[model samples]
Target chain A: MLTVKHLAKSYNGTKKSLTDVSFSVSPGEVTVIIGPSGAGKTTILRSINQLIRDDDGEILFDDVDMRQLNRRQLRDARSHIGMIFQNYNLIEPLTALENVLHGCLGTKSNLAGMFSLYRNSEKTEALQLLQKVGLGDFAYQQCRNLSGGQKQRVGIARALMQHPKIILCDEPIASLDPKSTTVVMDLLRDLATNDGISVLINLHQVDIARTYADHVIGINNGQVVFDDRTAALTDTAVTDIYRKTTSSERSLVYEG
Target chain B: MIKPENQVSLPTQLPAGPRFTIPLRFRDRRRVTMLITLLILGYVTLITLPTMIPDHFKLVEAITGFTENIKIMFLQPHLSNTSWLSLLGGLGQSILLAFLTTLIGSVLAFFLALASTRRFAPTALVLGIQSFMAVIRAIPTVLWVLIYSVVFGLGANAAVIGITFHSVAYLTKVYADSMDELSPEAIETLQAMGLKRPAIICQALIPYLKPSYLSWTFIRFEINFADAVAIGAAAGAGGIGYQLFMSSSFYFDFHEVGVMVYLILAFAVVLEIISYRLRSSNTAQH
Candidate 1:
């Protein structure tokens, strides 16, 4: 489980990227954040991982404040919090198996990781994860040669390699096609239900979010405009969430 | 269905005096600048050519003498007078000098590059190392060798030390540039995975830089090889270059000069082949 309370972030000390965002994710649940571009969907995910430190508020992982942890403690905590990116963010020159094996770097000793002295058990698990993500035959294939879908599959396997409690994805299917998008979304949902791993995803596609998410949080202008069970989310509410509004119009409007 | 009043009119054609206009403000200036540069270079060459070759007949005579000397040197080489053992030994020494300097220089440069890269180090440290390398590279390798010879005394040691110094500076700049070309995302992702800086570099950055590093090292080795040869004679550093210098300047043995020249050329060509093979094989593996 993960809990973020009153989180706020501003890049230039001016316009806020995230404002007073609060959310919680339960185990074996898939929570999707839907927003238009620059609405701080990715920012919220990054702040939880401390990739971009939030200006205010606490991120609690199973009731422990991550902000209060020392460097060593934070690193240990982060090892269990896996993250996937829109670009896959794989080491391109490395093979699919090797990229998955990299997930063990934080857990392994520095010297062991440097020399790739991973134990046989670790390698087996990495391979299994790859197989689970449908990349068993392409284990030795370089990530550079992989298609967008394959690369994202490898990304999922890599995140699973950490045996993470919570997995955060920043538009994991943004660059993927419609078919691949369904496969990846399905994979994430299966991981949540079967593996009991909490999944938090940022997505721009409302239809995909509605299709995949158990709970959906709609964000606009750095604020959470709507939050409800996917089934309870009305078509009118969805339209209102994504409706184009200028700064002048925002001054005339208020949220209850 | 019958909403004729609500139908929108779309314009089919544009009203224009000129369909397209060329923006020539910058283009015309660039052309004029290039033309002026060419004209000045041509004029300078014209004025300097006569001074460069004071007499045409002397130039012709010198060329004929050079060709005749080459013919006599290669066709009727004084093989008996040349010592094969010493010549080979000198060649070996020159190669060893190149190898040692490149090895030492590349190792040193690798560390300096890591420290100097903005992605790895603080801004002040990066700027300081970069400026320091720039200063080292501004002075020619020969000048660096000469400076070292003054400090360490004239010998192969001085040549090796000086060449290594220049090589390090050269490689630092190149290696840093290559490292800078790596995508920040790779490192950031690793960092987010809780990897330490060192682990991230080993797992992400080094693999990306390996091919470029090898190519740069090989290129620097070739340069150091040439520098070793030059310094051998210029600083009395005892190598094939010294023998070549002696044969040409003191012994006036053009045949031996031709032999040495051919030997050096053959060595360079072989090195080129080896480098090409290495680069190609590396790319193929990747």
Candidate 2:
């Protein structure tokens, strides 16, 4: 379980990227955040992982405040929180197996990690995760040679390698085709249900969000405008969240 | 039916204009600029022609003599003064000097490059190391060799030191550039996975940089080989270059010069083949 309260951030001293954002993700639940572009959906996910520090917030993971931890403690805490990106972000030159095994770097000794001396047990687990993600045959294949869907599978296996309690996904399927999108979304859902891992995903596609998410949070203009269960979300409410503003409407009227 | 409001009266007489007018002089700027440039070049050549060639007949005679000498040198090569074994031995020494210098220099450069990369080191340290390498690269390789020769007394050791010094500087710049171009996404992902700085660099950065490192090292080796040949003559380092210098300057044997030139060309071609094979093999593995 994870909780974020009163999270606020501003790139400059004036304009806010996220204003008073708060949310919680329960275990084994998929919480999807949907918004138009530049609506601060990614800012919330990045803030939770401490990739981008918030000027005001308390991100409590199992009752420990991430903001209060020092550098070493922060690193230790981050091992329990996994993250996936839109780009797959797999090391291109490394094989899928090695990339998965890289998840163990945080736990291994500095010298051992530098030499890539993964224990047999860790190697076994990494291979099993690869197999679970349907990349067992491509374990030795370099990531650069993999297709987009296959690469995202490797990314999933790599995240699972951390044995994380919570996983943050930032537009994991944004670059994928419709077919690959379904596969990745289905995989994420299955992992959350079977492994009991909490997932906080930032998505732009409202239809996919409504289908997969148990809870949906809609954001607009750096504010959470809608938060409810998927069943309770109306088509009208979704439309309003993504509607173009009135200033543009007025300009159109003037041109006409 | 035609609309009454839209209808207009037509002009009876055609507009008076010249049948054939001169074309616009400055319609296209590029053509005009080129013509002006050609005019200036021709004027300059005409002004300088008399000064450049005061005696055309004497110049023609000198060129003819030079051609005759070249024909004699290549058609009839003399290999009597130096034995084949000594010439081969000198060639081997030059290659060894290049190899040793490149080996030591690349090792030093790898570490210095790691330190100089912005991803690994802080701004102040990276700037400092980069500035130092720039200074080293600014000086010519032969000048560095001459300086070392004065210190160590002319020999192969001086040549090796000089080439290594310049090689380290050259390789550092190239290696640092490749490292700088490394994608930040992989590094960010690793950091998110809780990897420490060193682990991230070793796991993510170094493996990505391996191919570029090898290619850069090979290129630097080629440069160092050329430097070795120059230093061999300048510093009195015993190599094929020294033999070539002696044949041309001391013995005045153009035929021996021809043999030395061919030997050097053969070695250079062999090195090119080796470098090409290595780079291709590396790419295939990746």
| Per-residue lDDT value at A66 in model 2 | 89
**Location of the lowest summed lDDT over 10 successive residues in candidate 2 chain B:** B51-60
Over B31-86, each residue of candidate 1 has an lDDT whose tens digit, in order, gives 88999999999999999887876555586789999889979777766544569888
Candidate 1 segments whose C-alpha is farther than 4 A from its true place? A249-256, B1-57, B73-80, B282-286
Q: Please write out the lDDT profile of model 2 over residues B13-64, one tens digit for every residue.
A: 8778987778867478898899999999999999998788766559778899
Scored against the native two-chain complex, candidate 1 gets a DockQ of 0.42
Q: How displaced is residue B210 in candidate 2, in Å?
A: 2.3
The C-alpha lDDT values of all candidates are 0.88, 0.87
lDDT of 1 by residue, A1-256 (tens): 7888888888877667777888888899999998888888988998887888888988999899887888888888888889999999999889999999989888878897678888899999999999999999999998988999999999999898888999999999999998999899999999999989999999988888888899999988778888889997789988878878686855543221
Candidate 1: global Cα-lDDT? 0.88
* Tens digits of lDDT, candidate 2, A135-159: 8999999999998988998998899
Give Cα distance to truth, residue A147, candidate 1, Å: 1.8
